[model samples]
Target chain A: MLELKNITKKYGNRTIINDLTANIKDNEIMCIVGPSGAGKTTLLRCISGLEKIDGGQFILDGKQFDPTTSENNVVGVVFQDFQLFPNLTVMQNITLAPELVLKQDKQTAQRKAQELINQLNLDGKESLYPYQLSGGQKQRVAIVRALAMNPKIICYDEPTSALDPNLRDEVARIIIDLKKTKVTQIVITHDMDFAKKVADNMLQVQPIK
Target chain B: MLNYIFEILPSLLSGVTTTLQIFFLTLIFSIPLGIIAGVGLISKFKPLKAVLEFYVWIMRGSPLLLQLIFVFYGLPMMPGIQIVFPRFDAALFAFILNYTAYFAEIFRGGLQSIPNGQYESARVLRLSYWQTFRKIIVPQVVKIVIPSIGNEVINLVKDSSLVYVIGIGDLLRAGNVASARDVTLLPLVLVAIIYLALTAILTFILRRVEKHFSYWK
Candidate 1:
């Protein structure tokens, strides 16, 4: 389980996320839903250590886990726009982190990446660049890229924002399928219907004025 | 006209050789230096950023001709510093410094166009800073700044003519010498044709490169 206790995040004088406490179970899909400016992305960033927690602690498996917003932090994030490196093909995007950070050999990384690509139905699409992919394909490739890092938890920021409105079913199916990987999934979305459809438990965020 | 062209072609070709040398050397050194300086301009370190910012301001605010004059003539005469650079070295130094600033500003603009999400995604993915820079950001920045940098490169070709001010015997200087001695504009016209040919070649190469990057956006 991941425990976030009294997590506070601020930007200069204003507080973005204030004394937030939450518990996320292992191997579950947790959805965060809120209106715009409600600090939903802020909370997701805090969990992923993309933003520093001004106050609070993350306790994992009864040990103090200090994850800073810096190198080799064991959390993954898929941004709203799917921010894949456009210069690189889908295979390069998915294989790069494992090869560079984890020191996996090229063959090992390629094999693993190929597995993820095949599993995600991104098999022949590996050679294609990010801009060449559809919104759904890009989102899947982003997921594969994150998974390549073997992160403890993967967070998605508005995963459906770039996708067609009809593709929420695919997004929901992806989330449910991810449960078998045993990696905790945290998704931030404003679409409550999608959230309700996919969430094992849901979080609503409010910004402090 | 053909006999006149043949009469001047050898000297003019030597000048073209010098022009190509200076162009390639300046281009090779300045671009890497510019990328370093451009990224340095936004660094969180106040003193380093301030110094870079100030240096860029000086380079951009002054005329490149004045900088050449200063490097060649003024620096050795200063009280505390009296080191004299050779004529070729001085001109090269001034050109490199001036162009580095221009290229750096272009790169800074490229860096700015990058969305914040790219950085955040890098951070969360556990890639180190240098890793993110090398594999992710620089490629994108290069794509953004290629056209701007191409403009600078073409400018540099024409601006290499300015070396004649310091008596470096580059293409234009050779043309001027021939024009005066022979009492004809023929050599100068030939020189202009040479420059135009060089620019046409570069424009073709740059267009092909732009087409290559068209796959991305």
Candidate 2:
């Protein structure tokens, strides 16, 4: 289980996420839904170790995890912009972290990346750069890149914001499908329908104002 | 006119060769040096950053001609500093220092233009600091700075003429010498043509490079 206790985040004088507490059971898909400026993204960033919580404790599997001191790969993030490295091909992007951080052998990393590419329906697009991929394809690649680290938990920040209205359903379907893999997922979105459709348990973040 | 041209051509050609030597050497040294300096400027180390900032300030705040004179003449005159560089070496050193500062500032702009999200993505991907810089940041920076760097390169072609102030006998100096000896303005006009030709070639090559990067556009 992943748990947050009284997590507080601030940017200068203004508080973004204020003493928010939440938890996700193993293999649960938890959706954080709120209106804009409700600190949903800030909460997600805090959970992913991308932003330090000014005051809080993150407990994972009954063990205290320090965001400032611990290795950050425990929680992976797929940013709103996708933030794909434009210079690397899809295959290289997925394989790089495994090869460099995990010290996986090149053959093993390549094989795993190839499998993810195929699974994500990005089979022929392995050699293509991020700029060459469509919005949907790019999102899938971003998910695959996150998954490559085999993180215990993955956070998605405004995943559907970049997609067309018609394409938003595809992302929901993808999130639902991810639950079968038994990895914990935290998704932050303002779209209430998406939160309801994919979340096993949903939390609404109130604006701190 | 042809006889007059033949008389000055050899000297001008030799001078052109010397100019090319300085230009290539400065580029070889300064580009990499500037990149390192730029990275250092942005680094988290306060002391290194401060030292580099001071170095850049001095280099950019003063004229290249004055720097050349200091390196070749002024330093030797200092009581404790007994170093005197040869005229060509002093000019080369000064040009490298001055251009490296400009190049470093250009690189800093290119590096900064990359959105913060790029670094964030790399971090969450579990890439080591070095891996992120090498694979993610550097390639994009190269693309962003190419046009700016190209402009500086063309400027360097013109700036090489400044070395003649220190009596290094670059192409402009050869032209001046020939014009004085022949008592005509033709040799000076020829030097202008040579500079135009050099800049034209650089512009053509830079255009091709820009087209190459258009793949991302």
Candidate 3:
């Protein structure tokens, strides 16, 4: 279980997330929905340890999680823009984190990446750069890249914003498919229908006035 | 005019060798140094960024001929510093330092052009700082800066003529000497042709490089 207790985040005098609290059970798909400027992205950044929480404690599996001392590889994020490294091929993108961060051997990492690529239906597109891929293909590549890290939690930030309605439904389907694998997912999005389709639990964030 | 060219050809050829030496050496040292300095300029450490900015300011603010003279003559005359070098070495040192400043600015612009999303993605991927720069950022920066760097390189070919002010017998100086000896402008015209040919070859190579990067485009 992942427990966030009294989380507070401030930017100078204004508070973005003030004493917000929530819990995510293992393998649960929790969706956080909010309007713009509600700090949903900031909250995701804090949970991923990209931003510092002014006041909070994270308890994971009955132990207090310390961001400073821990390696903090527990969460992986898929950025809203897909932010694929433009220079690397799809295969390179998927294999990099596994080889670099996990210290897996090249053959092993490549093999695992190939499996994920096949599973995500990205077959035969391994050598293409991010620019060459369509919106749906790039999104799948991004998901595969995140999955290759084998993090306990995968967070999607505005996953469908760049996609058309058809692609958005496709992404929702992909998320529902991933839910079967029993990895926890935290999705931050403005798409209400998408939230309804995939979320096992939902939390709404209100902007601080 | 043909006879005059034949007479001065050997002398000018030798000068071309010296000119080529200085050009290659300066490029070899300055390009890498500029990359390091450019990355340093954007580093979070305030002092390092400040020092690099100051160095760039000083180098860009002065003329290349003046810098060559200062490195060759001025520093040796200073009481405490007492830095001294031979004419060729001094000219080379100045050229490298001056071009590095220009290249650094070009590189810094290339680096800054990369969106913040790239870095944020790397961070969330658990890539170490060094890995992120080497694997993700550097390749992209290289592609973005190639055209700007190519322009600078062509300029360097012309700038190599500036070494003549420091008494280095580069191509232009050879032409000047021959012109004075024969009382004709043929050697000077020949020098211009040689420079044009060199830049043409450079342009061809850079075009090939740009084509190579078109895979991303």
Candidate 4:
């Protein structure tokens, strides 16, 4: 289970998230939805350990998300912008994190990523660079790249914002498919229809009064 | 002109070995150093960033010839501190330091040009800073910095000839020696051809590298 208790985050004078808390269970998809600057993205960052909480507790798998003490508290994140490595091919992108961070052998990582590429229907484009792919294709690649790590939880911030309406439906379908795999996921997005499509549970983030 | 080239070709070919060594060494050492210094310049730590900024400032502001002389002759004359090495060692140090600063700025600009989302995406994937830099940041930075780096590399090939001031007997100096003996100015023309060839070869290599990273294409 992943839990955020009494989490507070402030940029300066303005407080973004104040005493915010939530619980996400296994095999569940939790969607965080709100207006712009509602701290939805910030909350996701804190869960992923990408942003520091001003005060509070973030617990994942019984051990709190502490960069200082934890040995292996892995959280996979997919950014709204789709941070694809421009130099690497699509296959390399999916395999890189496992080879470098998880210490998996090259052949093993390649085989695993190949399975994901085929699963995602990205087989023919395996050797293409990120720049060569369309916006939706890159987003799918980003999703599988996160999946390749086999993390306990996957977090996404505006994953389909870059795609056209037609393409957004395709990505939304993929997110729904990911939910069946039994990994906890937190998605921060403005697309309410998207939230309705994939979310098993929803959390609303309100701007500070 | 054809006859002149045939007669001087042997000696010119021999000098090519030294020229190639200097070019490779400068590239091998300077590229990594440049990336480090570039990161330093952008670091959140104010004191270290200021020091790097000033170092780049000084190196960029001064003439390469003046810096070369200072490294070879001037610094050693100071009372307490001394750089103990051969004259060529001193020259090499100057060349490396000088090119390192210029290359660092090129790297800095390339890094800065990348969108912040790229880094955020890496973090979300649970990649440590070093891993993110090596796998994600460095490759993209290499693509962006190639044109600027290509220009610097071409300049460096010609600048390697500057070692003649410290008596290294590089391509230009060898040409000078031949010119004094033959009194034909043929070696002067030969030096130009050699420099051109070096730049052409460097340009070719960089293009191949650029193609490897052409993800968008």
Best by lDDT: 3
lDDT of 3 by residue, B92-115 (tens): 899999999999999999999999
- Model 1, A1-209: lDDT tens digits are 88989998888988888888889889888999989998998888777776778999998767767777334546788888888888899999988888888899999999999998988899899888888888999999999999999877889999888889999899889878988888899999999999999899998886566
**Candidate 3 chain B minimal-lDDT segment of 10 residues:** B1-10
lDDT of 4 by residue, B1-217 (tens): 7987787777777677777777788889988999899999889999999999999999999988888888888887867998665767777788888899999999999989888887877666667888988887887787789889989988989888887887776788778888998897889888888888878888999888778656453
Better of 2 and 3 by TM-score: 3
lDDT of 3 by residue, A63-103 (tens): 99955345747888888889999999999999998999899
Highest DockQ, which number? 3
Q: On residues B1-217, what C-alpha lDDT tens digit does candidate 2 reach at each position? A: 9998998999999999988888988999999999999998898999999999999999999988788888888888989868888888888898899989989988888899889998988887767779888988998999999999999999999899988887888999999999998799999999999999999999999999988877663
User: Could you arrange the candidates by TM-score from highest to lowest?
Assistant: 3, 1, 2, 4
Q: Specify the highest-TM-score model's number.
A: 3
Residue A183, candidate 2: Cα error in Å is: 1.4
Per residue, candidate 1 scores C-alpha lDDT tens digits across B1-217 of 8988898999999999889888999999999999999998878999999999899999999999999999999999989989798988998999999999999899989998988878777777777889999999988998999999999999999999898888898999889899999999999899999999999999999999988888877
Give per-residue CA lDDT, model 4, range A1-209, as digits (tens): 88889999999888999998889888788999999989998888777777778999978768767633344536778888777877788988888778877889999999998888888888898898888898888888988898998878888889778779888778778888877667788889988999998899999988999
DockQ order of candidates, top first = 3, 1, 2, 4
lDDT against true structure, model 2: 0.88
Candidate 3 docks with a DockQ of 0.76
- Per-model TM values vs. the true structure: 0.94, 0.94, 0.97, 0.85
Q: Where is model 1 more than 4 Å wrong at Cα?
A: A69-73
In candidate 4 chain B, where is summed lDDT lowest over 10 consecutive residues? B208-217
